[model samples]
Target: MVNNNEKDKSSQVTEFSKEAGYYLQKGVHCLNRSQLKKALKYFRKTIETDPHNTYTHYNIAYILSRIDYLKDINETFQEILGTTYNLPEASFLAAIYYSLTGEMDLAEKELEKFLEIAPEGEIMEEAREMLNLLSGEEEIYENLSYIKLSEKYEGVIQTVKEKVKRNLECPFFRVKMLENLYQLDDDLTSNIIFLYGLAENSTIAERVLRHFIKSSWAKEMHKELAMLALRDIGAEEPYEVMMENRIVKVTLKEYFERIPQWEPQWYQVMEKALENIKYNKYHSKTMEGELKEVWNQYIKVAYPEIPPVRDINLWSAALEYLTFKKRGINLNHKEISLKYRVFPEELLEKYKEMGQALSR
Candidate 1:
């Protein structure tokens, strides 16, 4: 059923993809051999041909970090994370980047994400050490200013109470100190976790309580106590539910200061639409931010009586189309919808709805 012109076009596209794959393999091989310059050479070639390849971009970010070219690494890192949510290595690297930059809150949050998702590996141990380092609780990993002070059961407990009373240490340090003591005196683990849970850093407390529940260091009773502490803190995965569909674990409040009062579905739909943009031609960081701004603007006027979506991909593609249209780019809606696996008619309908929503 295909015509000669379509076949030729498909053949050229396949050949181009093959060229990109060849460069990617060469880059990986050179990287494995510790040939840094050659690896970068090939990786750059891969990016030129297949700019949206996630692993190729990740390799470049890794190399850039290794060579101390960190100025633009965050932008590169965030772009990769946007496309691939399950890549724990990016999160681990991002955490280290944040720590070096003195953004402890972001660093700790990234490390928690890495620890939660990364399976058993050498990186897992390193992530734990990084957590300790970020908290200034250990003398690990080079000659960092932080040092491990020796602890005795009685002395450590007394120090914890005295610090809590006098406010000698910050909330994070106080929690880490209690964690050390919890290891020393298993019998008082519940009491220690209770103190730890109420340490004012609810985020860190919620994180470590779950760590205790999973780690072998905590006894069964200690695990129960950790769970109780978690409940007392009242922190749960997915602080809110999306009435439109399934659950998303992230709390957008961390990302947005004053989250819109719209239903959670709009947010989830936006995220799904964004996810659908990964590895495509529309996956630039600037474009992603612009699309989000578009969503925010659209939702501002459309909220409270906004339309529901059965196909988030169609919504996503239409979002891109609408943004292009607003920018006067004149992208073909039919072609865009086909690329996103939706009907042309449906995409146009959604795009019109979005435009009208913004008008109101």
Candidate 2:
């Protein structure tokens, strides 16, 4: 007969295994619901119980890459694949890593290997498309030259179009390419706004705008999109473009009805003008009249109760900072402005040359 101690140990092992399975299932449920944080907690519990589970390791790696915390990711990918060389998820993820790091040929090979194993799943379709993109057999993005973007980087724009066509699921990649296109000429960026407006998917348009909103041009486009969404969707509103940036509670009819009015409670055409003026405060002839008019009128009514210029400045500055970051520019205006007494004008001017030329 087994000793009591050995029996107890065996029982404990069974209990731990059961608990690990429970948490793994819970984690999957959370992932299905898009509760990534909760999913991660459950996954972590599973890891603590079954440290050697390669499938668990693969799940963790996939989540990590999605959140963009890919430090030592190469090693993690290696660990997962090293444990289970034939795992489809492991191969697909490894291919993605390779694609991002410029290992196109390796990425294609890994994806092809994955398709060979699981050729019927949705994942297989994605892998096949990625393979086409990596091999340059099909362009990644659709050519949007008909949209009338700037001509300066026609070649790069074509490349971007190819990338977009190939990987429709990767919002980050699409946004990145649009950014590169915009840098070559602001006119192209402006045209992107128009192109994006024509997009059937709001998520895609949002990605395009979010990628570039820090720039004056992109912000201008976003304001346009916001208006389009408002007008097209018929959002209810009291229609105040608050001195505050946050969308205040309002009605759709009110917003539409007030667009042409000059009443103190509502601002319509002036919203875009003022937004432009905030960044381009030291304006050229184009912005001077409008800025001065809004500044003079707005401060008179909202003085003492108004939010500080510093607040507005900081907000716009934060946006500018985000744009610069997206472009791989190192300057952080918030810190610089606080520490050395720098101004938006200087930074604005630097980007303006690039920002203004995006489109005509």
Best-fitting candidate, measured by TM-score?
1
Candidate 2 error regions (>4 Å): 1-70, 79-86, 143-360
- Each model's TM-score, in the order given? 0.30, 0.28
Top candidate (lDDT): 1
The digit string of per-residue lDDT tens for model 1 on 250-341 reads: 33232122233445566676776677656456455545556767887887667666777667788888888887677677777777877788
Residue-level lDDT of model 2, residues 3-40, one tens digit each, is: 97887677656556555665665555555455556665
The lDDT per prediction is 0.56, 0.47
The lDDT, on a scale of 0 to 1, for candidate 2 is 0.47
List candidate 1 stretches off by more than 4 Å.
1-165, 168-301, 310-314, 326-328, 337-349, 356-360
Q: Model 1 has how many clashing residue pairs? A: 0
Model 2, position 314: C-alpha lDDT score: 39
